[model samples]
Target chain A: MFEHLHAGLLAAVSMSNLIALFFGTFVGIVVGILPGLGPMVGMVVLLPFSFAFSPDVALSLLLGVFCGGYFGGAVPAVLLRTPGVPSSLVTSFDGYPLTQKGEAQTALSAALLGSFGGGVISVVILIFLAPALAHVAASFGPPEYFAVAVFGVVLVVMAFREQFARGIMLLGLGFWFSTVGIDGTTLSERFCFGTLSMQNGLDIVPICLGLFGIGQTLILVERDIMKTNDIKLSRSTLDFSAIVKVLKYWKTLIRSGVIGTFVGLLPGTGSILASFLSYDVAKRLSKEKERFGKGTPEGCLASEAGNNAVPAGAMIPLLTLGIPGDALSAVLLGVFTINGIYPGPLLLVKEPVLISTIYISMLLINVVAFLMLIIWLRPFAMIVKVPGKLLAVVIMVISMIGIYAVNTRLFDAGVAIAMGVLGYILLRMGWPVVTLIMGVVLGEIMENRLRETLSLGDGSLGILFQRPICIFLIVLTSLIILIPFVLDIRKNIRNKKLNQF
Target chain B: MPKKDYYSSRAHDLLGSIFGVFALSMLITSPWQVDTSGPDPFYKGPLIFPLIVFCLMLAGSLPSLWRLFRPSEKSSWYLDGQGKPFKTMVILGLLIIYLAGIIFIGLEVSTWLFLLIALKLVNQDSILKLTLIPVLVTLILFVIFKYFLDIWFPEPLIMEIFLE
Candidate 1:
């Protein structure tokens, strides 16, 4: 462990990696402070650049943005009462009320410091817990992988159970898209439509850029959301005294960090839920329970710590299990795979140095983002005044050009545009856009493992039942799919009995 | 409770039918799209995996689609109404033209023009924002893409004559 950490410390301090870390985090904070644009869009737009650097640098840049965005998300929530990231909505409950009481500094400071503390704790947990988790995951064979992929998909669909059919249809669409280009197993062309571009298969980066970047821009434009609010921020600065004040709530920080990381460990449960859960618990446990909804530093600390802890916690799953816990981590999976660094049991065994560097880089990013937020708090707060529409337009253009730069391919840009339309249609229809991405990310592993498992069993799925882990995964997936239907049937039966009475 | 769906039931039926038709196409085209000529049986063919997925999708969509058409069932199959598709479509049109513009005109010129028009569309109240922000943004993008990032941009068709 010392050897790996020593190597990580060396790699992390390299001039290029350090620069990438700072740059990615800065961009992350800027985007996170902006309304309607969050880490996912920032990561996708910047994903093309990730290929230019080594995997260590690439992951650092993207992960910096991932963690940094959470730190910055608290700003707009506190100052403007608009959660820059959806997860930061919890922060706003106490954050905004504090701003109204002219205590914005205390609120924002506690939020940032608590975020910093939670982020560090989460990384510590990941550094210790992930390797042990990977040891168990090392035993995961083709059947286990296949079953787990199905479980991941089931979790995502169930998260959007309100539109179950829509989720399945979009998942099917993403799976279909993944099957385009040459089939690796058979070396046979599939779904190319006689186009050379399709022969290479669709890249996840461009599709993400389209969906979250361009497609989201269109939604914002249609809503005319930019014209709705004029953003203004009074002067706010974080001092050492504020940090001292925030540190007084160390218990809240630790508790929320644990809750956040544990929630993040679960697949498909997002940071919003983590923040809310942490806030509820903190409120319930507090002697000043009445102070939660009103302006209180403890409330901001709890919520911010919870949300900030989530990125590292989510990375725990992504880095070890090769399964993303949420949409941001799912995109991060693309970066990992693109660099030929597939995260699984093999990752910990094979690339201990890279893993350690990621841990160190995550820690460095938290420190750097916290300091940057403190020093330039006013500027970041002020940039929030930029109209959402302009940001949308800028993001859309960057997405197109950035995606084109990936391989200098016009076809990728076209794919992005096409997916943008599909994403927009889905979003308008009230379907979650990220479900398609989740399906796409898991599709390859699912297919490859299922095929491998089938060949092992001579084309019989009974092999899945034989494995303990696969059986557990399958049973969980089955329950997820069946429980809603069973409950609805019970409801109907009860209603009929009441009517008869 | 769910918000009263903004879109009427008819629009929702359209969405359901789209999925229904898409599923049907996948099922119909699977045989041709997937080759099964190897020594292996159809189950082992490249088609099996996608086939399984499409079947599951059909299972999900078909029930919903069936219920949509049945008047005796819940007649209020609904959608979260599209907020302003006409506006979004207009932006889409602009984006299509922008892509075309990049192919014909150079990236710098087309981007400047695209941002100018886009800014004007979004913030008609600010003339300076429409005129200046575009130029500033374009300049910044050029510096970053050209020098800092070292990204390659495709030369426009007009540049072909200059090359010759």
Candidate 2:
């Protein structure tokens, strides 16, 4: 392992590989600053170019894009309040507030440093523990997967503080949408309703654009119309003392990074949940919990580190088990497929060098992100000062055109618009759009796995319980779901006692 | 807690009842006939999942509807129909029209017209910015998708005659 590590580091330092890292990270930052474009789109768009380079160099370039893209999202999220990608939504909580308070430099610096630390730590985990983790993941069967999916649904219920019925409705609607394409087992179209585009099912990008961009932009327009003060850029200089203040919270930083990597390693659950969970955990543990929403650096470390650690964490399940841990990793699986590299049990023995190359590339990209942040902090901060109304129009138009360009089908644009309206209505009713999105993406995986489990004969649902890892997952999920309800009931009882007093 | 709370809860009760009934009816009336003999023989087949989901939907709606009628301690988050539903309805209607138009009028024209109207709808205050942005965007997108990305779009009827 040490020998492979040395080889990987030397390979990473080659002139061509270093150049590839720089180029990928540079493009990633630009794409991250732009709204409605994400690492998946960036990867898919660049897939064809991979044919032009060697496998090692291509992997280096793509991993560079992945690591750099995660940090890049912080640029727009902190500066423009646009949340350049979905994972960055958590960053906007303290990040934007810090920016408004004229500490844009401090906020961005904390985010960059936290992102770098978390990413490197996660890569280290991947390097040392991936084969062992893959052995564990291989033991997981359909029933355990189903239990995890149920845990994801329950997490959505707890996180979303709206009427439970509406949230469930969104889940049901998403599940129904998932059944639209051809049934994978039965080979019959469930709800194509005569359109070929729907036959492939709704594209995730179009659905995402409608829910977040168009739906969100409309809400932004309404807010802007009602808002009193225009968006103002902060003029605060970066203070060295502020950097030292964040360093004081190093324990919280490491804890959040570990939590994020663990969450990322979990199948189906992704960065969005990891970031929010870290925020909640940080708040619960902090002496200044009440100050979290008001630009606390501890809050920044928890969320930024939590989200940034996820890309590396996501690669764990993908490289080891052939299961994608999140949406972006799912696309990376496709890239691996295109390059004739099957990422499963055989990957460790058959292609150990390739795996080492990816790890080395991930580490190098974090350094690139840090350097980019230092040079471009002020220039990037200027993004928020773009007039809100103008920024909105650009987002809307780009969303419309980008969705249409995917397959050259205007029907997709229609699907996006209809969803946009539905999303707007759901927003008015206080339903959680993010939970609905999670349902849409994860529901199909859960459904297919459930079907597979039930198909196994001899009534051995106990087959799932046979494996120790499966048993552990079942116990853990039960605890996660039940503990929340128990806590909620306990709080209610305590509140009743207080009221009586 | 407030009068606004009472009214909103009542409204949710009504809306949930309507949606619940609609969902149940769709389940019953949906054209899902079970064919058992294809590839896999299992108890929990394709139709079973849909049926279970429908049952869950109806069951979930019952408690919410009961709360609406009885006014329970739970708070409701519904706002009182704040924006005009009809304007959104019109935008949806135009989108459908644009989809149908794509088969006849082709991609560029329908896309151009759809975006122009969508821009107008989103930014009603700035006509000049709205008009200028959409046109420039459509052309630039045309270049990116057509020349650079090299994906195929339906050629306009005029371009089909002239360029071909």
Candidate 3:
């Protein structure tokens, strides 16, 4: 391990790789700080260039973006009450409150420090645990894969417990969308409705840009962007004391990091879930729970730490099983495939040095991005003062161009605009758009794996229950689904008893 | 009951039922033809997942539809803040126009025009700043996407005529 780290360090320090890392991190920060444009869009925009660069350089660039984007989102969340990325929504629950209380500098410092710590811890886990996890993943077959995919869908539904029905409905909608293209086995089109472009199926790029980017822009427009009050930043600098103040929440940081890494290991469960779960856990465990949404440093620490850890955790499934743990990692899979670096169990065996270099690069990216953000903290705070109308125009233009640039197809731009309209309607109707996107991401995998499992079993459904791993996953999924209901029942009974007394 | 409360109360169920009808139509109109010659003929069809999904959609919508007819707590129908309907309509209309313009006039010109119009609608800023900002931003984006990344934007009919 030490020897591998040494080799990785040497490779990562190369001039070209260093330059890629710097630029990737810079683009990531810019994309993340801008509302509605998350790391996924940034990576997608840069994906075409990955074909021109070496695998190490390409991977470094994307990883830098992935890391920097997660931390960069906290800037707007803390200062402007607008989350640059969905994962930072939880951060703003406390971060924006801190800003309102004239503690924006403290909140920013805490978030950055928490992000750095979580990033480092997650990398250490990746370095030590990924190889062993890959070994276990190597033993998995179609039935196990099918079970894990089912577990992912269920976990996503569970994440939106308050809106379970809406989540499930959106998931169904996503599944329907996934079935549009030519079937892998039969080559028969499912739901193209006679349109030739529909036969190619909907691309994730347009869906993301439409739902997250354009949809968000429309909502912002309705909110009257020009009328929003400018946020005033406190005059205090993020000094040594602020750093020390954040370090006091070390326990929250570490716990959130662990939770994030584990949740991130699940296929299709993304960083948003990890952050929300960590925030919930932190609030539940804190003695001063009443202070949770009211400018508590611990709350910000938990959310920032959890979200920043997700990219490393997501790498586990992508590297070991060739399956992406989340949408962002799914895009990374495309980058890997384009660069002729197929990620599977053999990837580690064939390119151990390259993988190690990626790990080293991620570690370096976290530190470099943190320092750069701290140096430019004041400037970023001032970005919130930019008129919302200008921001909306820029976002709309970028989203349109970015979607069109993917395949140079006007039809894709149409698809994006259509999805944007649908997304806005769904948002107004109180539906969860993330679930729909997740369903689309996981649907193909589930269908392919289920078909494979059935073929292996000669059409016997019993085979799915026969494997120990499959059974374990089934039981786990059942528990995840049922526990909330049981808890609800217990609460109801207790309330009734108290009323009788 | 107030008109807003009445609409808000029925919105979820109305939307759910509409979605259910759409799902049913999709399931019924599925175009996948099963390959009976294959060894696993039944499993080879592409419509199985879609069928399951549509069924789930119908199932999920049923409860909401049922609740619509039953007495329920009052809910606000207005999703956005009051007096913003005009702004919402204009923004959506602008988006639709932008999409059409992209196909008709090309991405660069349409994007520039869209930005100017959208900014004018939302802000009282000087015409120069709006024009310059959009022009500058568009040129920068065009260079980065076209020259650096090698993305090809479709040429408008006017440009093609001029070139010819």
Which docking band does candidate 2 fall into? acceptable
- Candidate 1 TM-score versus the reference: 0.94
Worst 10 residues of 1 chain A by lDDT: A225-234
**RMSD (Cα, Å) of candidate 2?**
5.9
Best by DockQ: 1
- Per-residue lDDT for A217-269 in model 3, tens only? 77666664322346555553456678787787888989999888887887656
Highest TM-score: which candidate?
1
TM-scores vs. true structure, each candidate? 0.94, 0.74, 0.85
Which residue pairs collide in model 2, if any? none
Which of candidates 2 and 3 reaches a greater lDDT? 3
Instruction: Give lDDT per model, in order.
Output: 0.83, 0.68, 0.78
Q: Write the per-residue lDDT of candidate 2 for residues A363-414, one digit (tens) a residue.
A: 8898887777666655544544444444444555556656666666667777
Candidate 1, clashing residue pairs?
A: B7-B81
Chain A vs. true chain A, TM-score per model, equals 0.96, 0.71, 0.83
Q: Candidate 3 on B28-138: residue-level lDDT in tens?
A: 765343222434455545666677788888787776667666736654344434444577678778877887776678877887888888888876379787879879887
Per-residue lDDT tens digits of candidate 1, residues A1-501?
899999999999999999999999999998888777788878888898888899999999999889989998999899888888889999999999998887888889889988998899999999999989988899988889888778877887888776777778778877877787787888777777777788899999888888877777787776653332433344545776878977888999999998899888877788898899999999999889999999899999999999999998988878878888777888989888888789888898799899889999999999999999998888788877677787788777878778888888888988899888977877666676667888788777778888898888898989999999999998889999899989989999999999999
